[model samples]
Target: MTKAQIGLIGLGTMGSNLALNIAEKGHAVAVYNRTASKTGAFFENAADLRERIVPCATLAEFVAQIRPPRPVVLMVQAGKAVDEQIAALREHLEAGDMIIDAGNANFRDTIRRFGELEGSGLTFVGMGVSGGEEGARHGPSIMVGGAQEAWRQIEPILTDIAARFQGEPCAAWLGEGGAGHFVKTIHNGIEYADMQMIAEIYGLLRDGAGLSAGEMATIFQRWNSGPLESYLVEITAEVLRASDGATGGPLVDAILDRAGQKGTGRWAAVEAQLMGIPATTIETAVAARSLSAERDLRLKAQGAYADALPTGRLVADEAFIRDLEHALLAAKLAAYAQGFAVMEEASTEFRWDLPLGTVARIWRAGCIIRSQFLSEIAAAYDQAREPAHLLLMPAFVDTMTMASPALRRVVARGVEAGLPVPALAAALTWFDAFRQGRGTANLIQGQRDFFGAHGFERVDAQGDHHGAWSK
Candidate 1:
C-alpha cells in the first residue's frame, strides 16, 4: 500500500478535526494517539474517509506510515506533553522528518525547542492554528513559522485546510522560529480585550440602561449586521438569546460571572511589557480576568461599598444607543491597533521580518478576531507607504476622528453610571496618548532623575540631561 502523505499525533478535538480536514482535502493522513483506544475510535468514526486515514497504535507504526521527508503535526498540550511526544517521535523518525507543533505554546518555549532540534538533521515547525474546533474541522487560520524550505514542503496541505477570505487562503508562512506562536499570543490578547469590551457594553445595557437579556440580544444582533459584524458579536447575540432549559430564564444569567483563561493573554501582556510596548487594552483585559476570578472577594467588596456606590443610571435612548455602537467600534479599532503594533515590534526584536499584512489578511477569516475591520488593516499595510503605526494610517485617522467623540461620551457616561469599563477606558486613554505631540511623561522623567539619578532626554538639547533636584 502507498504510505500516507502526512501524519498527525493527538486525536483530541482539534487534532481529529484537522485530520478530517486534511483527508477531506484529498490527502491520506496517518493519525495516532497515546491512548490506543482513541486511535481506534477515531479511525472507526472516519466513515467514508477511513480509506484516507492510517490509524497507528504505536510510535514506530506511526512514523513508518508516512513517507520520507515526512511532515507530522503534534496537536497535543502546550508544555511538557509536547516535549514528551516530540522525544518519543524522535526515537522512531528519520533525519529529514519535520515536527510541526500546532499548539498554543509560549513563543519562548518554541524558540528553545528550535535550539534543541538544531543540527539534529530534523526540521521543526511551530504553527499556530486558530478558530477552535469548528474551524479545525472545516478551515482554520494557519500561521506557520519555520525554515522557509520546510514551509514550502508543508504549504500545500496547510493552505488546503485553511479558511479562505474571498479567494485567498488564510494560511501563510509568517516567519522563522517562534513568530507564529508569538502572533497567536497577540491574537488571543486582542480576543480577550474584544470580549471584555463586549462584556462591558453588556453590563452598561444590563445595569446602567436596565435592558433585558432579550433586548441586549436584539441589540447585538443588529450590531452584527453593521460595521461591528464579526464571529464574536454573532456568538454574543446567540448566547444572550439562549434560554436556560432548567430555569426557563436567560441562559447567560444562569452562567457564572467568572471567566477562565489559558495564559495566552497574560503571555501577550508580558511580552509587550518586556518590549516596552503599550498594550494597555490587552493588559487591562488580562487584569479583568484575574479580577473576575476573585468572585468571593468581589462579592464582599460589593456588599461593603453598596451604600457608597453610585446609583446613576444611563438612558438607553436612540441617540445613546447609536453612541454605544460607535463607541464599541472605536475601542475595538484601538485594541487591534495595539495588537498589530506589538506584533510589529516583536518582528523587529526577533528579526523575524513578519509580514504584517499577511497576518491581518489571515485574521480576516478563520481566526477568533476575524472582522471586516481586519480587511481595512490589511489594506493599510498594502499601501505604498505603510504608516509607522496602524493608527497613523490616513484611513484609520479619519475613522478615529469621526468615532472618538462617541467613545468618549459612552465611557464618560458609563463611568458616571458606575459601570466597569476598563478595556474601553484603556483603549480611549491609549488613543489619547498616541495622538498627543507632548505628553506628561516629563514629570515622570524628572521624578526618576531626582530620586534614581536616571538620565532624561532633553527636548532642547541633543543629549540626556539631569534635573537640578539637589537644591
Candidate 2:
C-alpha cells in the first residue's frame, strides 16, 4: 500500500474531524488513538474516506505508516499529553520528521517545547486551529509558528484545508516559536470581550428595553447585515431564535447564566498586564465570567439589594435601538484594537516580526471572531505606513468619532438601568484614555513620589525627579 502523506494521533471530535478533512482533501492520513478502540471507531466512521485513512494500532505502526520526512499532527490535549506524545513519537520517528501541536497551548509552553526539541533532529510546529468542530471538518483558520522550512513543507496541505476569504486561504506562517499560539490567545481574548459586549447588549434589550428573545433575535439578525456583522452576532440570533424542546420556550431562556472559559481569555489579560498594556475590555470580560460563576453569591446579593435595583426602563424607540447598534460597533472596535495591540507588543518583545496585516487577513474568515471589520483592519495595516495603534488609523478614527457618542449614551443608560455593562464600559473608558493627551496619572506619580520616594517624570525636564513634600 502507498504510505500515508500525514499522520494524526488523536480521535476526539476535533481530531476526527480534522483527520476526515485531510482525507477528504485527497491526502492519505494515518490515524491513531491512545485507547486503540477509538482508532477502529474513527476508521469505521470514515466510511468512504476510509480508502485514504490508515488506522494504526500502535505508535510505532502509526509513525511507520507515514512517508519519510513525515509531518505528524498531534491533536491530543494540551500540556502534558502533548509532551508525552512528542516523547513517544521521538522514540519511533527518525531524523527530519516533524511534530505539529494543534492544541490551544500557552505560548510560553510552546516556546518551552521548542527548547526541549532542540537538537533532537525533529522539527516542532505550534499551530493554532480555530472555528470549532465544524470548521475542523470543513476549513479552519490555521496559524502556524515554527521554522520557515517546516512551514514550507506543510504549507500546501494547510492552505488547502483552510477557509478562504474572497478566495484567499486563511492560513499562514505568522512567525516563529509561539507566535501562532500567542496570536490565538489574543484572538480568544478578543472573542471573550466580543461575546461579553453582545451579552451586555442582550441584557439591556431584555431588561431595560423589554424585548423578548424572539424580538431581540430579529434585531440581532438585522444587525448582522450591518457593521456588527460577525459569526458571534449571527450565532446570537440563531441561539435566541432556538426553541427549547423540553419547555417550548426560547432555548436561550432555559440556559444557565454562568459562562465557562478555558483560560485563554485570562492568559490574554495576564499577558497584557505583564506587558503594562491596558486590555481593560478583555480583563473586564474575564472578571465578568468569574462573577457569573458565583451563582449562589449573586442570588444572595440580588435578594439583599432587590429594592435598591434601578427600575427605569429605556425607551424602546427606533433611534435608541440604532444607538445600541452603534454602541456595540464602537466597543467591538476597541476590543479588536486592544487585541491587536497585544499582538504588536508580543511581536516586538518576542522578536517574532509578526505580520500584523497578514494576521488580520487570516482572521477575516474561519475564526470565531471572523467579521467584515477585520477586512478594514487588514486594509488599515496595508497602508504605506502602518498606524502605531489600530484606533490611530484614519479609517478607525472616523469610525470611533462617529460611534463613540452612541457608546457613551448606551453605557450611561445601562448603568442607570442597573444592568451590568462591564465590558462595554471598559471599552469606552479605554478608548477615552487612549485618546486623552494628558491623564490623571500625574497625581498617581506625585503620590508615589511623596509616599515611597518612587520619583516622577518632569514634563518640563528630561529626567525623573523627586517632589518636595512634608512627610
Candidate 3:
C-alpha cells in the first residue's frame, strides 16, 4: 500500500477540522488557505492542539511542498470559488496529479470539470464529504466520483479519515464522472426530509400530547434503542431538550422555527421531478419550510382560525405514543423512499455502477442521514438486483406490518394537530400507493407521451380498448 501525502485548502471550520483529523491520524498533510493569518494560526494551533503537521502559505508552495502525483483537496465554497482556488493551484500542479473538490458542488460542474481536465494526466474527483463540521473532526462520509484508478490511489488515506460503516469506511467510488456530487446532493436532500420529520414529531408532542420539549426528548431517547435508532433521532432529542440561557424558554421555541436550507435540497427535488421519481416527502419538506418562513402570514391566520377550531382533549402519553410512533415510522419510510428514488434515478441517468447494497451499507454510520434500517435496506438490495422491490420483500413487509400499527395512529394525531407531516404522509402514501394501487393509471405515462411524442400502452392493448384522444 502506498502512503499518500495529502494537501488540503480552505482552513475554515470544515477545512481546519479535516486538516486536524488528517494530522491526528499521523498522515503527512500540508494545508493552504488564502488568508495568511488562518494559515499561521492553524499551524500554531495544530502544534498546540496536536504536533506533526505542516502548513503552506501559498497554493504553489503547498504544491511544491508535497511530492508529485499529489492528492490536493480543495475544501472551499462550492460553485465558482472551488474553480478559482483550483485554477490558482494549477499554477504549481502538473499532469498525473489529482484535484478533489470536497465542497457541496453542483454535479453538472463536476462533470464539466472532469471533461476539461481529461487528456491532461491530472485526475479530478468531485468528492462530497458529509457529517458536517463534526464529521470533519472525527470522520465523514465520502462520496468519490471520477476515474476509478484515481480512487484506487487515494483510497488509503481516504479510508483512514472516513467514518466506519459495517466495518468499512464511509467512502465509495459512488459512480462515474459527477456521481460523487450527485450522491452528495441527494444525501443533502435526504437530510432536509429527515430534519422535517423530526420537527413534525416535536409538533405532535406539543400539540397533540401536550408534552414539553423535555418530554419529547425523552421519547426520542426511548426510540434510540429500538429499530428506529439513528444519529439524527439521538440528536433530535438533545436539541429539543436544550434550553435557552437568558429567556429560559424551551430551546425549540428559542431557535428559529423557520428551517434554513441551501440549494442542495431544491436540487434533489428538481432532479427527482425530472427523473419522474416521486420525492413527495422531500418536496413537501421543502415546501413546508418555505411556507414556514412566512411568519407574518401565520400570525394573521392565527386570529382567523382560533374561533373556528374545535375543542379536543389532549391525548395521554400511552395513546399519543401509539400515533406518534406511526407518524415517525411513516415519515421515516417516506424519507427513505425519496432517498432511494433519487439514488435510482441518478444511477440510471449517470450510468454509474452504483451498488445499492453497498451504498446502504456505507450509510450505516458517520453520515447525517444514517439509520438503523440501512442494514435491512442493504440486505434487501443484495437480494434483488433492483432496489425497487424493497417494499415487496416478505420479511420487510412483515417488519413494516409490525411497525405500521404504531405509525398509523401517530400519523392520525399529526394530521389532527395541524402538524407539518410531509414525511409521515409521504411514507404512508408510497406504501399505500404501491401496495393498494398497482395497475392503476398514473397519468404520467400519458402525459410524457403527449409532450415528448412518446407512446403509451392502452389498458387493454391487444383488446383494442384505446382511449379516443387525438395526437
Candidate 4:
C-alpha cells in the first residue's frame, strides 16, 4: 500500500471535513482520532474517497503511516488539548517531521510552541483555517506560518483545497511562528465589528424605522449588491428571511437577543490595547457582545427606567434608509481600517514581514469577513510599499468623505431615538480622531503632571517638560 502523504488527528467537524477536502484533492491522508469509533465511522462513510484514507487506530501507527518528514495536521480543541496532542505526537515523530496546528489558538501560544520546537529539529506550523464547517468540507482560506521548507511541502495540498478569488487560491504563507493565527484573530475581530455594525443598522431599521424582518432582509440583499457586499451580510439576509415553522413568522423575531462569542474577538481587542493602538471599533464591538450577555441585568434596567425612557419610532423615509446604508458602509470601513492597523502594529512588533496586500487578497474569499470591500483594500495596499493607514488610501479617503456625513446623521438619529449604536459611534469617533492634527491628550498630560511628575511634550519646542503647578 502507498504511504499516506499527510496525517490528521481529531475527526471532529473541522478535521473530518478538512481531511475529506484533502483526500478529494488527491493526497493520500492518514486519519486518526482520540476515539477509534469516530475514525471507524468516518471511513465507513468515505465512499470512493476511502481509497485515499489510511485509518490508524494508534498514534504510533498514524505517525508511521505518513512518509518521511511527515506533515501532520491537528484540529483538536485549543489550549491544553493542543499541548497534550503535541507532546504525544513528539513522542512518536522524528526530527524534521512537521506538525501543523489548524486551530483557533491564541497567537502567543503559537509563538511559545514554535519556540518549544526550535531545538527539536521538528517543524511547527501554526495555521489559521477560516470558513467554518462548510468551508472545511469544500474550500477554506488558509493562512500558514512556519519554516519555508515545510511550507513548500504543505503548500500544494493547502492551495489545492483552499477557496479561490478570481484565479488566485485563498491561501498563503503569512510569516513565521504566530503570524497566521494573529492574522486570523484580527480577521475575527473585524468580523465582530462588522456584525455589530450590521446589527445596529438592523436595530435602527427594525425599531426606529419599524421595518419587518423581511423588509430588512431585502435591504441587506440590496446592500450585498453594493459596497457592503459580504459573507456576513449575505448570511444576515438569509437569516432575516428565514421563517419560524412553529410560529409562522420571521425566524429572527423568535431568536434570542443575546449574542455568544468564542474569544478571538476579545483577544484581538486585548492585543490592540496591549499594543497601544486605538482600535476603538473592535473594542466597541467586543463591548457590545459582553453587554448582550447581560440579559437579566438589561431586563431589570429596562423595567427600572421604563417611565424615563423615550418610546416611539422615528418614522424613517427613503432619505433616512439611504443615509443608514452609507453610514453602515462608512462604519465598516473604519472597522476594517482599525483591524488592519492592529495587524500593522503587530507585524512591526513581532517582526513578521506580513504582506498586507496578500492578507487582504486572501480575505477576499472563503473567510467570514470576505467582502467586495476587501478587494478595494487589496488595491490600496498594492498601491504603496506601506500605507500610513488604510483610511489614508485615496480611494478610502474619497469613500469616507462621501459617506461620513451619512454616518454622522445615522449616529445622531440613533442617539436621539435612545437607541444604542456604540460600534457606529466608536467608528465615527475613531475616524474623527484619526483625521485630527491636534488632540485633547495634552490636557491629560497636564493632569498627569499636576498629580505626579509626568512630563509633557511641547508642540512649539522640542522638549518634554513638567510644569510647576504651584507657580
| TM-score: the better of candidates 2 and 3 | 2
Worst 10 residues of 2 by lDDT: 379-388
Every candidate's CA RMSD: 1.1, 0.9, 3.2, 1.2
Residue-pair clashes per candidate, as listed?
A: 0, 0, 8, 0
lDDT, residue 404, candidate 4: 100
Q: How many clashes show up in model 3? A: 8
- For model 1, give the RMSD to the true fold: 1.1
In candidate 1, what are the lDDT values of residues 381-434, reduced to their tens digit? 988274379888889899989899999999999888788999999999999998
lDDT per model, in order? 0.93, 0.94, 0.79, 0.93
Ranking by lDDT: 2, 1, 4, 3
Candidate 4's displacement at residue 319, Å, is: 1.1
Candidate 3: C-alpha RMSD after superposition? 3.2
Clashing pairs in 3: 96-121, 323-409, 323-410, 324-410, 326-406, 326-407, 331-423, 331-424
Model 4 agreement with the true structure over 1-471: per-residue lDDT tens digits: 799999999999999999999999999999999999999999999999999999999999999999988999999999999999999998999988999999999999999999998899799999999999988988899988877777898999999999999989999999988999999999999999999999999999998888999998998898899888899999999999999999999999999999999999999999999999999999999999999999999999999998987675776688987898899999999999999999999989999988899999999888899999888888889887755799988899999999999999999989988889999999999999999998899999999989898999888899889897994
Per-residue error for 106 in candidate 1, Å, reads: 0.6
* lDDT (tens digit, per residue) of candidate 2 on 189-237: 9999999999999999998988999999999999999999999999999
For candidate 3, lDDT tens digit of each residue in 1-471?
123388889999999999888878778888888998999988887765444466777676788877778999998888889888877877778988899999989898899998877886778998989888899989998889888998999898889989997578888887789888988888888888888878877776687567888888888898888767889999988887888897897777777667677789888888899888888888878887888899889889988899876455457557667556655765676577667767877887789867878777777877898888888888888888545655566667776777766666666656665665666677677666766755566587667666665666665455322334677
Clashes of 1: 0
Off by over 4 Å in 1: 384-387
